[model samples]
Target: MDYHTIRPHPDLSSIVKCYWTLEVPYQNDAQRQLIVPDGCIEMIFILGDDVKRFTSGDEYIIQPRDMVLGQITEPFYVLPSGDVKSFAVRFYPYGFSNFVSISIGDLVNKETPLVSLFGNEVATALADKIRSAADTLERIELVDAFLLERLITKPTVDGIVKRTIDAIFSTKGKVSINTIVNDDSSKRRQLERKFLKEVGVSPKQLGKMIRLQSALKMLLNNHTGSLTEIAYESDYYNQAHFIKDFREFTGTTPKAFLGDEGMILSSVFYKQD
Candidate 1:
């Protein structure tokens, strides 16, 4: 299992975290990888076999070549086909809204095909350019160009959604529904409706997802840190509580997770909040 991460270009730095490429050589039957829940959205370019995304008790097939994955609101798992080789550009929760007219909330509950949202030809071209690129940096540039072009066509974030997103980031995903609501709960309801339509998930769900994403980053990048320490730092009540939440999202224990090379191949794909 090998993984490489490349930073996004300056023009896109605020929206895109980085482009991540993974290569896994088959040795034998490997355990299915448990990809914990996270907040950010991704545009995955499959260079080899297909990838399976399991969420909310359902399985969605991500065919080899190209696709865009929206913000994951619920816990999910993924398993690579016989041999794994893929690359993806990870986008910040707020950054994605800039490229599409829809709200960040709409991307939550599912994975929509990039072709449907961005058009088949455009999606295919972007994926091909990235897969054919000689280096990670070049791939980043190509993705940046793709986003820049879309930004011209998409609607900018409205004041209400902008304010709501600001609150989420400020609270580090701990923002309550009450906080986002106006004096009346009507705002909350409207937000929920809009969020589901544009972002694909509720504001509360995205907050939890973002919070979990932070925890995963620390655990994967700061390997020396203990799970208990990570849990506390990530704002979970305690180690036991954290493990329960983690397992609920990932379908496996954290310690066992580190031992699986295939699991590590995917976990490293998440971009820290």
Candidate 2:
């Protein structure tokens, strides 16, 4: 397994978090992989065989080669049909909304075809450019160019929403919404509504996801501490609080997630980052 992330062009850094690629050797029988939410959205382009996304225990749909995966609220499963090769654009929590007119909330927990966001012709041209690029670097250039074209008339991000998201990330989700809005009820409601439109999740939801991500990073990095310690480090009130949040996002206990074959992808992805 090989996973790597590259910084976006300096000009686009505010919107594009990074460009990431993952390549895993083929397995005759690929194990299902568990993917948990992390408070951001992604646009993925698969360059290998079709992968199956499990909607239920025994049902799944093959993911589109080029699609945008919206804000995920729960754990989902997927399995590779063969060797895995994928490249994706990871967007900041408040970034994607600038490119589309629709409310981001409508896209939660789903993979919508890129054509749905961009028109069919534009989507097809962009996908072709990405897929035919000679290498990852070339692909990045193409993607950057595509985004630049669309960003000519950059949509203004809500100032409060942007600041709130920044605070959540800077504190690893320890900051409360009240702190973010400074206890103004009107501001809080406004932020909530704007957050849904721009980030696809409420401020509280995004904070929880960010906090869980911190815990996951700790565990994956081999922190020599107990779950209780991880919980405190992540700002949870107690071990029970940590466990409850962990299971909510990952669909399993921390110990079980560590031992599960379904987490191979997440383990590698997080470890590399």
lDDT of each: 0.69, 0.91
Clashing pairs in 1: 104-199, 105-199, 105-200, 106-198, 106-199, 106-200, 107-199, 107-200, 108-199, 109-200
Tens-digit lDDT track for model 2 on 34-148? Answer: 9888887899999998999999888999999999999999988999999899999999998888788999998899899999999899999999999889999999999988888
Q: C-alpha displacement of 102 in model 2, angstroms? A: 0.9
Candidate with top TM-score is 2
How close to the true structure is residue 217 of candidate 2, measured as C-alpha lDDT? 95
Best by lDDT: 2
Per-residue lDDT tens digits for candidate 1, residues 129-191, read 777899767876787787787667444555575577668777767667786675568888887
Q: What is candidate 1's CA lDDT for residue 261? A: 68
Residue range with the least summed lDDT across 10 consecutive positions in model 1:
264-273
Candidate 2, number of clashes: 0
For candidate 2, what is the TM-score?
Answer: 0.97
lDDT of 1: 0.69
